[model samples]
Target: MSAMTMLAVGDIVGAEAAAWLAQRLPILRDQYEIDWVMVNAENCSVTGSSPIDGFGMTTEVVDMLLTAGVDAITGGNHSWDGPDVDKVLAYPQVVRPINVSEARGQGLVTLDGAGRTLTVINMLSPTAALPGMRAPQPKPLWPSWTELAASTSLPGAIVVDLHGESPWEKASFATALDGRVSAVLGTHTHDASLRGHILPAGTGYIADLGMTGRLGFSGGGFDPAYFAAQLRGDNPHKLPAYRLATGRMTLGALLLRLDASGHTKAITRVS
Candidate 1:
């Protein structure tokens, strides 16, 4: 079997870290011989003000990643928050929505690498931080996956990015797709889960991929005092803050090697 390295990343926030990835990704590809790269840019384009209006992915970031040889990009609840998201989703190589609908861009993308077609699917957990989404149920989504898979026209391999909250929910999804997909990777919780391994059916699974940001402060590098103050209902003046440090970001990614039938032969997590 041919080895196709697919690097999956967690949520990315801020410009500095984006620049770093842009600079570092190509080197990693050259060294590891990575064939495909997928990143979650939901929070990267958000301004954190509202769920719909975020400023995460600037043109610079996109250009950088494109130059760095990223095969496809995926996003979550924060996709609509940014001003440029609609346009960004227009790229034929980008995977935007979690479901297959008349909604702008696509959810399933095909990457021809290492002489095989790899199907990359992006799905949002119904209970995640979606600002405005319909009812959370599997009935409507099951058909979406069925239709998307039908449209691929290739059955070499399939990888699913199950973006959502709740570990049990993510695990349930993985179990459901046990023998179907090559891998199921979770995102959006910022906190990485300890659960990751190959299922009995050959699917590689992980509860959460964690996030890409400062490693100093807890809560995925966000200001803990600010979060605590908000919880305590206190509007404290001059809240303590940590200076954003370059290269302090931690990245979580899943590297998978799949068989010709899309079964995950091996799966590994890289921090």
Candidate 2:
């Protein structure tokens, strides 16, 4: 049987990070022998001052990622922020959370590559909403992964992106679907977790893949001063100006290798 490799990138923040990924991702894919690439781009266009769900993720940014060899782009709570979100989601390669009742984008997508068929599902946790955000976030409906697996006729592989706030919640979700899916990876924390392992039934799991943005800021994307003011309650209503961090930024991703039957063979973190 043949083996297929995939790379899942963490949240991408601001224009700088997007450009960084575009330049380096192809090389990384080649280096790692990756056949597919998935990126979390919820914060791709966020500037500190803009509304959380009203900015970020422009068409140019999406195009850049697509052109950079990313096979699929996954989003979380902030997926609806950009003006072009509806149009972007219309693309076959992009996906939003399936649990969102009112969101316009497709929650699940299927791709064929590397001699296998793969289904990728994107979902956001009910706890993903941050306090003080203007937009009202939706709560997950807690769908059954086993049922979802049974309903889908695709026989190759299944991978999920569980974007959420609490580690326990993400872990629990992964455990519940351990044997049913090929992998369940956590996102939204913007920091890589030490936990990365294959379950007893051959499913791959990771707590969080971290952020693929500038390193020296709150959440790895916002300016530190902005968060400082918010913490001090000095400027609660005023949005701070968004600035990409200065100096080097990190590219965070996880590489998974699956057998022809869609069972995980190996998982590695590449930063």
Top candidate on TM-score is: 2
**Model 1: number of clashes?**
10
lDDT of 2: 0.79
Task: Give every collision pair in model 1.
Answer: 44-56, 45-55, 45-56, 45-57, 46-54, 46-56, 47-54, 47-55, 52-81, 54-81
Q: Which sections of candidate 1 miss by over 4 Å?
A: 46-52, 100-102, 130-143, 147-154, 234-247
Q: What tens digits encode model 2's per-residue C-alpha lDDT throughout 158-226?
A: 889998888888878878777778998899888888658898888999989888887874556556776
Tell me the lDDT of model 2 at 131: 60
How much is the lDDT of residue 118 in candidate 2?
Answer: 76
lDDT, residue 101, model 1? 43
RMSD of 1: 3.5
Best lDDT among the predictions, by candidate number: 2
Q: lDDT per residue, candidate 1, 154-265, as tens digits? A: 3557888887788887787788889888888888787877657889998889888877766656746454555566558775555444233234778766677777666777
lDDT for predicted candidate 1 compared with the true structure = 0.69
Q: Give Cα distance to truth, residue 206, candidate 2, Å.
A: 0.8
Candidate 2, RMSD to the unseen true structure: 2.4
Clashes of each: 10, 3
Number of backbone clashes in candidate 2: 3
